[model samples]
Target: MGFDQYHEPPEELSQKVRTFARMITSLIEEAEAIGWYEQRISVEKDPQARAIMKNAQGEEFKHFGMDLEFLLRQKQDWRAELKEILFTTGDIVKAGERGEKKVD
Candidate 1:
């Protein structure tokens, strides 16, 4: 996603902008989890794989930062919920990779 993709806000759109902020944060959270696992698995002291994952993770961080800035500017109250969801998703991804069974 590029800065050019951001459209100018209309004068009367409040609720929808809030919803878009939430959606973008959720998408970024999912992406961060995926990148974390890819980084964790691509090992073997292989410089190439390590380099690739490093760049990918950095991009994910950039994405997260963008969403965070939007949230701060548009929906500060939603930040806590979004952060918790991101951390929970990361934990789930890590557990699944480890073959850990989820307890009902």
Candidate 2:
């Protein structure tokens, strides 16, 4: 089966675009791993197993952040929106609205 990241022909895509697609795929995998660990930790009966899952999840989440940072660096508008939406105290919806306005 073909990779989901490439909607178009791979031969037609530039190397930079392919690398970006790979990174996006990686980011999705990291996020999925974090969610999976959360579910496992929630249902796990053993404290030690849950602790290990939590630690692993923390690492996965860190990878997710790094992936997001990489994407932000590549996209100026996204970087601007995230700057407004993240680390601000208030209604989250309001922050998102403000962030959207920032790009427009």
User: Which candidate should be chosen as best, given lDDT against the real structure?
Assistant: 2
lDDT of 2: 0.93
Candidate 1 — which residues are off by over 4 angstroms?
Answer: 1-21, 24-31, 34-44, 76-104
The digit string of per-residue lDDT tens for model 1 on 3-80 reads 422366544557677477566757667576667757575653877777777777777767767766665566554554
Error of 2 at 42 (Å): 0.4
